[model samples]
Target: MTTLGLIGSGHIGSQLARAAVAHGYDVLVSNSRGPDSLSELILELGERATAGTTADAATADLVAVAIPLKDVQNIPADLLGGKIVIDTSNYYPRRDGTIAPLDAGEMTVSEFVQAHFADARLVKAFNHIQAPAITDDAQSAGTAERRALIVAGDDDDAKKIVSGFIDAIGFDVLDIGPLSASWRIEAGTPAFGPRRDREELEIDIAQATRSARH
Candidate 1:
């Protein structure tokens, strides 16, 4: 009965909640708007899901951050310290405003999130796929050509935990090295968006080139 905490209940967050509940994990869903706003979502998620404050969600066994990049600083860092956090954020200058480092190609979005969550075992995942794809594209284990999702983190154990969760929910996990190498699949890269299985994904990662930041 592991609890999966969600720090933002937007498209990605809500979709992940549905997937987690279907897989038997209790979910604590929260957003900047507060628990009351999530009542409709909670009822839709049925009994295993509870709407709570961001702080309460931060205390779950695993936490998923699906907020806009500009709002990352507002996440409860103190409570999330040492937690295995799955970061599913992508930087959009128009939406999140321009971030100097990211705009200059000096830091990956996940790295910026890591700096903020300093002590959290942060893993970059779910950022490359469409929000609906979170549940729609899941395939059982051993399904031939099963779609693969990429995960990057500095912690081996944390990556393993997140990878296991991804596998259970339907998809193969491809570790693309540490967070530093995560840029290989960021927004502009060939690895983002399109549905790719393990072999195809590896090729995309290899072909990834750092383009001038948008």
Candidate 2:
């Protein structure tokens, strides 16, 4: 995708916008407060970036749902139909309260988001990352100590596209299988840390166990 669209301008969303711009993708960033509220971030992102409504941003080539896990339903599905959506949210009961089904392990957080945006191709990413670490730790693609990010989705083509974006934004990618398998990298897993290198992540993903409970 030539343009990266963000539905939230918090830590993860802001960093993604900066990284996307640096990597040659124009970005449209939005927050619940509206475009006027994003003035500073737009200036920080420079010429390639613009502030728009959630709907406007959602219309771009690819969209990242970087809002809180409880807020996914607020994004209109009409704008996401047939689009490749990157889901960057993690469920923290202390923050998002108890999403019973998710807490019970009936489905991964990404699958829950997929149900909210049924027509969109949802790929889970950026959920386990800490933005401060991303800013300090990014390594060029093949650097020996480059860190890795896992993308989980059922759509191969959609996963391929998201993987390219991850590589461009300065990280390696490991397809940790489908969304059904995403709990392996969820908040409590080994792959969910703030300081893991590629080698470390390889071990983490491999050692990931099936937990029917998050």
Candidate 3:
């Protein structure tokens, strides 16, 4: 069984947990506030879910970083090494403060995260969809109208791993090139909010314009 580890229990993280459990994946969720703070969420997630430290969650088969951009520094470097990490963060200057490389358009949000978690296999995914849509719109495999999620990553094998999990969780994936092209589906772009199928998503990704890295 695939155990999905979540490093943030906010809207996106928690919703991702629900979708993971819906697909019968065991989940270990953690937040900066500590495991004790996540007890209620764990109870809601039932036996398959456990409240773990960030390091604990990092050890799972796959880990997703869904916290606010500013919190990226808190991610456990040593524990996340060798794990496939999903980068679900958007860099908001107002909330996260401005990053020089990002502001200069020289690097992307995924690149910023890559610099921090260099040892981990990073895949940029699950950042484009709205939190509520993740659960409300999930469809079983082969469903006719499955939604699509945009994915960008550096490693081919790593992207394939996350792609399989995304399929299992009810969304078809659009591999929109590498991590550098992550800005295509980032927040505020055409591919960011609306639920779209693979074809429509492909169009959106192609028509995407540069927006705030947030």
RMSD of each: 1.1, 1.2, 1.4
C-alpha-based local distance difference test score of model 3: 0.88
lDDT of 1 by residue, 28-141 (tens): 999999999999999999999999999999989999999999999976666689999999989999999989998888888899999999999999999999999989999999
* lDDT of candidate 3 over 1-214, digit per residue (tens): 3899999999999999998998889999999999999999999999889999988898789899999999898765566888899999897889998788888778889988998988989999988888999888988878886899978999999999999989998899889988899988776788888889999999998898885443
Best by lDDT: 1
Question: Pairs clashing in candidate 2?
Answer: none
Q: How accurate is candidate 2 locally (lDDT)?
A: 0.88
Please list the residue runs of candidate 1 whose C-alpha ends up more than 4 Å from where it truly belongs after superposition.
none
C-alpha positional error of residue 114 in candidate 3 after TM-score superposition, expressed in Å = 0.6
Per-model TM against the reference: 0.97, 0.96, 0.95
lDDT preference between candidates 1 and 2, better one? 1
- What is the lDDT for 158 in model 3? 93
